[model samples]
Target: MSIAKRLASQTAIYGVSSIVGRVLNTLLVPVYTARFAAAEYGIVTGLYAYVAFLNVVFTYGMETTYFRFANRPDTDRRELYSRVMTLLLLSSALLTTVLALLARPLMSLLSLPPGHERYALWIALILGLDAVAAIPFARLRLENKARKFAAIRLANILLNVGLNLFFIVFCPDVLAGKYLAGLRPLVEGLYDPTIGVGYVFISNLAASAFTLLLLGRELLDFRPQLTLAPLRPLLQYAYPIMLMGLAGMVNETLDRILLPRWLPEGFYPGKSNLAAVGIYGACYKISILMSLVIQAFKYAAEPFFFGQSNDKNSPRTFALVLKWFTLCCAMLFVGVSVNVELVARVFLQRPEYLEGLAVVPVLLLANLFLGVYWNLSVWFKLTDKTYYGTYIGFAGAVLTVALNFLLIPLLGYMGSALATLACYFLMAALCWWLGERHFPVPYPVARLLAWLALAVGVVALSWWLPVAEGWPRYGLQALLTLGFVGLVGVVEGRRLRTI
Candidate 1:
């Protein structure tokens, strides 16, 4: 198969679980926004921000390392995977045990009250299991089992979503032996009435364990040959990558963690901190559709790029991929941002969070820049100059933190929006500059600017069109999305048609 076809297949595989799964997950946003107040939802937001941070730390860049080493000619693929999985299992088990022992103190350190300590425990276990499962999943990708990769992903997400709906929508009244059939007697016997929040974690835990069960074949492939001598270089390579993950996560999640600390006092009298986080977070989910698309592209790109690093046409091909990715994401940005009111209404199901509508465009655009930055990031990763990623990520993290501190107090969550944009843009420029020094890819600078120009024009026209609410706005935006594709087809269609 052609690399492009392989890329498309892998992307679709990743996308099925990511984009489709997330689209299903989006169902919960409406439920959550409607069921919980912005303040209540803010707690969820803050908790999950910590989840994102913890996730990056637990995995510690091992997935990418797996892809790198597993592709090498001399590496014994199964043994390498077995060793990696062993290392992850031992480390994650030790960490999980230690964290469970110290859960209460860690909760307190994270500023959670005693009552929320169990939340810490549940998520820690979830993250640990996820960390251990990472290598098998990467093996699936390496073997080109895109269907299985996507299937497992979709199954996990579906389980989580289905359980959430059952708990939140059905557990309260219907399962009290009231009306719902097949209702587990367990719900009535030992369950607290108000443990809807806890059920979220329980569902995730169940699904995570199930995911591990599905990896039985991969797990059985583990050999006892996993020893310390062979792992030293991998760990050395991974340490900086882990730090880069940490820094990148901060840029992505700091706003959720810091809004409570940095919001101006009396911002909304009694309902300030969590409310701000909740609103920002709800609107944030609306923007995540773009991020999911970027992630799908990354999954397809990482292995492909790493393998193709030595090819003569690799630079030009990489440049075109970046161009295409940017144009496609730009279309998404304009489509979603221009008619956001419709999306906001359907996504949130709560009128109260409309305040965050203004931040959505900025967040989406920020995500587009971040996606572009990611494509550029491969230069350093391929050349083993990955220290550059760590440096850029560290700088971006500082920018994220400083901006949150400076602007959240003044402009509220919107400050975080601006800060995120600034940080991503800065990193994109910095990475491009540095990567050019080490490995120059001939990215179409002028044509790429034209694509952005086209997106700006499309958004301007949409804004001026005055579609007048409801279906009209969405209808016009849909047309604009299609029209942008048609326009792209006209400009670059023939070039892309070859393969």
Candidate 2:
């Protein structure tokens, strides 16, 4: 089979888990917006922002490191897996213990109310379990066990979605003496009606624990072999990656984390800054169309890239992949940005949460650059110049923070969106420039920019040109989307046919 065909097949398998799972998870946005007020939802958003950062800390780049070492010619794959798994297990245990011990203090640090340390405790467990389970998950991907990988991931997401439905939808009825009167006491004992948003975190914790249990084969089948000999080299390789991952998280999530804190006190009447955070978070969900595609591509592409690194035509393969990836992302940007209003109307159950819809297009464009940046990052990983990636990530992090600080007070969450776009654009541009210098791939730069421009131009025309909102506007958007797709087909048709 051709490389493109193989990558597409792998991506489809991974997408069944990632895209479908995220779509299911996103279905809860209405439930969340319905059950929790904006401020309440903000708390959920804020805590999960920290969760993203800590996840990087807990896993500490082991997944990529595992792929790196495991794919090499001389490495003993089993021993390497065992060693990486052991290190992660130990670190996760230690981190969980520390967090459990200091949950109260950390909650206080996070500016939670006096009684909400349980959220911290739950988050700690969730991150710890997920961190350790990460290696086994990566192992499945490395061994081309995409079926098992998708199964486990889909299982976890389904469990989480189920629990979310039960707790948010049905538990209230039970607690209100509407159904299952006998279980009311049990439900009341475990659930507080006022803690509506907290249930999201709790549901996630249950899912994480269940996932660990499901991966028993990877964790329990073989006795763990402990050795420190490979430890030094792995850490040396991983440290820079850890920095890059952490910085990437900051670029990705700092806006969510800092929006509430940085906004002026009483920015909105009768609402805490959490409401602002909540609004931003809710609107951000609209951008997930792009994010989901990028994520699935990363899942499939990472191992594929590493596996093909030794091939004579690998650089050509990478270049072609980036070209196609850019085309897809551009189409995604146009599709989502053009129909955002419809998406908002359909998915946003609460009219009040629609206030932040303006940020969706901005963030969609931002995520396009992020996807491009990920494709460009193959150079650093292939050339062992991962430190360059670290520098780019930190630079983007700084840009994100600086822009957020400068703009949040003025533009609120819109400022955050703009900052993210700038950070990612800069990062992608820098990676491309550096990539050419160090490990050039014949990326079709002009064609990619042209595709991006066409997408943006269509989005601009649709957004700016006064079109009456009715079947007419819908018709225009559909045409615009189809036009972009047709343009890509025309430009890439011959190459695709050859493939």
Candidate 3:
């Protein structure tokens, strides 16, 4: 098959799962902010932010390690799969056990409110399952079993959404009255209704555990081995990526972690700043469409590009792939930005939460640069110059932390958005600059800039146009979105057809 056809097939499997997964997850925004109070949803938001950071720590870059080693000429691919899977399984079991034992102190350490300790417990298990699940999923990717990979992902996510609806919507009131009338004694003893976000974690925990049942084939593929001969290079490659992944995650998620503490004091008793955090976070979901594309692209592109590293036409393919990736991502940015007011409403679910509409565009463009940087990063990955990636990612991480420290106190939630955008922009530039010397690809510099510039012009005019209350605003956004589509068709329509 042609490379384009291969990519198309892989992308379809990966993209459908991602789109479905995120869209399912987005339903939680309504479940959270509308059904539950915004302050309560903020706690949910903040906790998940920590989950994202911790997940990177637990997996510790093993996915990339699996890909790197499994493809090497001298390696026993089945043994490689078993080794990585065993490592993750052991680590996940140990981590979950440790957290469970220390749940009491850990809850107090994070300053959980009265009667919220179980919240810590449930999320820890969810993270554990997710960490272990990473191994089999990576194996699937290694085997090019994206269809099975997508199936597991979609199934797990859909189940979680289904259960969340049951608990938060259908069962809450009924169970609250019938079982809860008896349970309120226990509730008063150890639970809080406002902390209903715990049920969200509980639903995820069930789904995560259920996902494990489908990993049987991957686990039975080969016997586990721990000889130093094969393990050393994989760890060497993985350890640096762990640093890079950590730094990258901090850049992506530190804001969500910091916002609750960093906001100005004095308002509602339990949480005033939390509502603001939830509002910012809900708007963040609107940008999840960009995140979804990046995720699926990463899944398809990483192993694909890595396996192509030794191909004679690898650089040429990489260059072409990077160009197309940028154009598609930038068009997505334009699509979301042009119609953001409409998109924001779906996630926000409340009139007052509209304050976060401004950050949507900023976050969208930042993700565009992030996706571009990922494409450009094939240089470092293919050339075995990952130390440069470490440096770039670390620099971005530091920039993220420093910006949040300096600005969050001053500018509130908007500061977090700025920090993220700045960090990603710096990291992308550093990767490109360092990449050029080690392994240059003839990137379509002019075309990329042109697409970006066109997006800016269209978005600016769209924003400037009168978009008052009611359907007119939605109509204007729709028109702007269509204009972006029309422009894309003009520029790349012919090329797209040929591909």
Candidate 4:
């Protein structure tokens, strides 16, 4: 198969798991918004923001390191996998224990109520299970076990969704005598309504444990090695990646983390800062449509790029990847941004959650740039100058923090959205400039920018046209979205045919 074809197939399989699974997960947003007040859901959002940061620390970049070393010509793949898994297991255990011990203090620091320390503890276990499972999942990708990977991921999502529905929806209804009156006693024994949003964490923890169990075949060959000799070089290479991951998380999530703390009381009129955080978080899910595509591409592209590093035409292949990636993202940016109100209405059940819908376009564009940065990052990774990624990530992190601090007081979450857009745009631009200096790829920079600009223009026109609501607005958006896709087809028809 052609490189593009193979990557597409792999990405499609991964996308089935990521895109479909996340779509199912996204469906729970209505349930969450319906059942819990914005402040209650804010706890879920805030805790998960911390989870994103800790996940990087727990896995410590071993997944990418595994791909790098395992692709080396002289390395023993089995030994490398075993050592990586062993290191991950030990570190995850140590980290989880420390986190569990400090759960109460951390809860206080996170601004949670006095009695919610168990939330932190649950988060600790979830992170440890996910961290330890990282290598086995990465191993499947390296081995081209995309089907197995997709199946397990989908199963995990399905189970989480099932458990969430059972706890958050079914049990409460049963207890209320909505149905299955005889099961009320059984439900009462198992379910606590006061647990409320805690069920989100519980459902996730159960899913993580179940996923780890499902990967037993991958872990069958694992043997613990306490000695650091085999892991020393890997650690040397991976620590920078961990730092980069941490900094990247700052750029990606620090806004959500800082919004509630930094924003003044009564900033949004009748909403607490925590409620605003909840609104921002729920609206942010609308932008995940773009991120889902990026994530699926990342899953496939990382290994593909490394394996193709030695190919003569690899630069062109990389260029083609970015070209198509940007084009598709442009379509998504236009499509989702134009119909954002309709999308928001569907996903966010509460009218209050719709307050932050203004941030969706900015965030969609931000995530597009993030995906572009990921593509450009293959340069540093392939060159083994991964520290360059660290520098770039920290640069973006600093900018994100500075921008958030400066703008949150002025424009609220819109300011946060703008900060994200600026951070990702800077990172993508900087990565491209540095990649050209060290390892040039013939990326179609002007064309890609044109596509993005066109997308933005289309979205602006869709909004500015002042069409009436209902089918008319929907029809116009549909026409404009389809129009953009059609233009891309005409422009790239020959290239598409060849591919």
Judged by lDDT, which candidate is best?
Answer: 4
- Candidate 3 residue 4 Cα shift, in angstroms, is 1.1
Least lDDT summed over 10 consecutive residues: which range in candidate 4?
A: 221-230
Misplaced by over 4 Å in model 2 are 174-191
Error of 4 at 346 (Å): 1.5
**Model 3 CA deviation exceeding 4 Å by range:** 102-110, 175-195, 266-271
* CA-only RMSD, every prediction: 2.2, 1.7, 3.3, 0.9
Q: Give the lDDT of residue 165 in candidate 1.
A: 80
lDDT of 4: 0.92
Q: In model 2, what is the error at residue 21, expressed in angstroms?
A: 1.0
Candidate 3 vs candidate 4: the TM-score winner is 4
lDDT of 1 at 92: 90
Clashing pairs in 3: none
Q: What tens digits encode model 2's per-residue C-alpha lDDT throughout 1-499?
A: 8889999999999998999988999888988888778888888888888889999999888888889888889998888888888888889999999888888887765577788988888999999999989988998899899998898899999999999998898889898888789998888787778767778988999999999998999987444756777698898888889999999999999999888879998876677888889989988888877899999999999999999999999989999999888888888899889888888876678877988888999999999999999999998987777899899999999999999999999999999999999999999999999999998899989878977887889988988758888989898988988888897888789988887
| The candidate that achieves the highest TM-score relative to the unseen native structure | 4
Question: Candidate 4: where is the Cα deviation over 4 Å?
Answer: none
Cα lDDT tens digits for candidate 1, 239-340: 778898999888898888888887877885666777878999999999998998998887778888988977999998899888878978987888787778
| lDDT for 471 (candidate 2) | 88
Model 1 lowest lDDT segment of ten: 187-196
TM-score for every candidate vs. truth? 0.94, 0.96, 0.92, 0.99
TM-score of 1: 0.94
Q: Report the lDDT tens digits of candidate 3 across residue range 292-368.
A: 88888888888999888888888778887887888788778887888777676677777656777888888888788
